[model samples]
Target: MRALLLSLLLGAAVLPALAAAPTDPPTPPVPSTTDGLIAQPWYRPHHLIGQVAGGQGMVTVGVGYTTLRGRLDVDVLTGYVPRKYSITPMGIFTGKATYSPWTLGLGASRWQVRPLSVGGLVNYTASRGMNASLDGKYPKGYYWWPARSRAGAFVGGRVAYELPTKANGQPRTASLYYELGTNDLYLVSLYSNIKALSVADILTLGIGVKVDL
Candidate 1:
């Protein structure tokens, strides 16, 4: 009887020790956060500026974010075009925000011969599906002789494709796109003034690099 009692005591001690052996609580699934949402290859912010073939220069800076569902991008741009024959300068500043497939943008600009102006842009992306965009702007300043307040409006469209890649086991992606558009200026003075400005139909192209954080 004593041996049996001792055996029972030993079993109890061993069972408790086994139960107390550190158990790895099931790893709580790693909490997901907005930080995770920003870890995509398209999430990093970037800055780009360059001069076109005609001596016109432009600068842009922006950030982008993407997830399994969709994406968002916002950017600011400033451009300058020197007068063809005079010492005056034409300048523009714009802020653009967009979602995949559709784009919306607004801008303010000035000219050596014109007043402060505001403008809007709208675009559609075709490669990603059926998407469309719309934008507008209003000028706050004056224009040169014979020209009224240089307020203007613009509309545009584009097609884009995102190519995904990997470098050293890290995610990387790039985008290719093309756009076309037209602009209208509200110059109240010039009797024969040209209000409609056609954006030279050109293939707007850009390449970007992204990193996951």
Candidate 2:
């Protein structure tokens, strides 16, 4: 009778212990909100870009960063123009920013359209033979604008095709874009001779491509 009572008591204790133990898997720890942003290195660019003919150079290549949910892109580019196009071979360094207010998705397709894009650029041209505004050859105030530097604004559009997402779930894309732009010098000339110089005469067209990293 003593042995039997001992076994029963043990059984009762084990039954309650087993019932209290968890059956379901432990809940996973939640991810921190800033984990994704903090994981990315600051020097890593969001995209790589290349372009042709926008008064910057005959050919330009660069890297860019995308922000504000891909609505804004800021880029830095290095451009080259052969001697055939200038007195000497010229290298152009440019910094630009582009903003696209809207993105429209094509129905059930990977294509996306940015119907309007507005941007501005500033560039400095370096060439051995190029005249500098501050050079002794030009008297003070003789030229109001810097000959080797130019600032411009453009309006353009882009079409992007989305690719597979990265391991981290960031989307990838390839895009083709076009820009119509004019420089400050061109604007000044146009203003001085509005009747003789039409908007088309001062406009420059640039074509380019961008690939998301």
Candidate 3:
């Protein structure tokens, strides 16, 4: 009878040990959800705009993304002088694409002249929102502001710097830049009477903000 009791007690202890032995945690199946895919770092678009000094206004819109640990940016801009002019508007359209350490830009401007000016630029960015560029512009029409078509080519450079801040959980950025260019304006009907439309010295200052969509 004692042997029988001992055997039953040993069986009970062995049964509990077997029950406690760990089993492979039910293999957690890989997540199959949209949120899971988006949880990884990915590309997003950004933009900015601001006012020009002296009551004149300027605007810029652009898209950019980050990949391979580098940044890619592209932007277009337009500028206007308010109330001082009518009919023949003066403006510029600029498109630029930039990769880390190198940038390329193309621009067209109508300076109250019918000239369809086209230009290209090469630049380098030293830091966030800071860069220097060497650019060129060629005018095709008359410089009518002076009652003459000025056909010429201009070469210039610009330096730009920007600052960023946040308030109320929003991003605000501001920028200031200056440009200097020089080229000869060919007076229509007077080949010998040429004037220089000093493209080499202009300053642009602006402030802007960012929003997510």
In order, the Cα lDDT scores of the candidates are 0.33, 0.90, 0.32
Query: Candidate 2 lDDT, tens digit per residue, 121-166?
Result: 9999999988788778877888778889999999999999998977
Full-model lDDT, candidate 2: 0.90
- Kindly provide the TM-score of model 3 when superposed on the true structure, using C-alpha atoms: 0.28
Candidate 1 segments whose C-alpha is farther than 4 A from its true place:
1-36, 39-70, 85-87, 102-170, 184-213
Q: Pick the winner on lDDT between candidates 1 and 3.
A: 1
lDDT per residue for candidate 3 within 109-190, as digits (tens), equals 1111111212222221122221213222325432323211111222222222223423322222232222222123222323
RMSD of candidates 1 onward, in order: 16.4, 9.3, 18.1
| Model 2 quality (TM-score) | 0.82
Structure candidate 3, residue pairs in collision: 115-141, 142-149, 143-149, 143-150, 180-200, 181-199, 181-200
| Residue lDDT tens for model 1, 1-213 | 999999999999898878867774656544343222433345355323222211112322234344433233344444444555324544544444433433222233111111111223332111222121221222433332212111223222322222343332333333322222122332232224445432243223332223222
Query: Of the candidates numbered 1 and 2, which has the greater lDDT value?
Result: 2
Off by over 4 Å in 2: 1-39
On a 0 to 1 TM-score scale, where does candidate 1 land against the true structure?
0.35
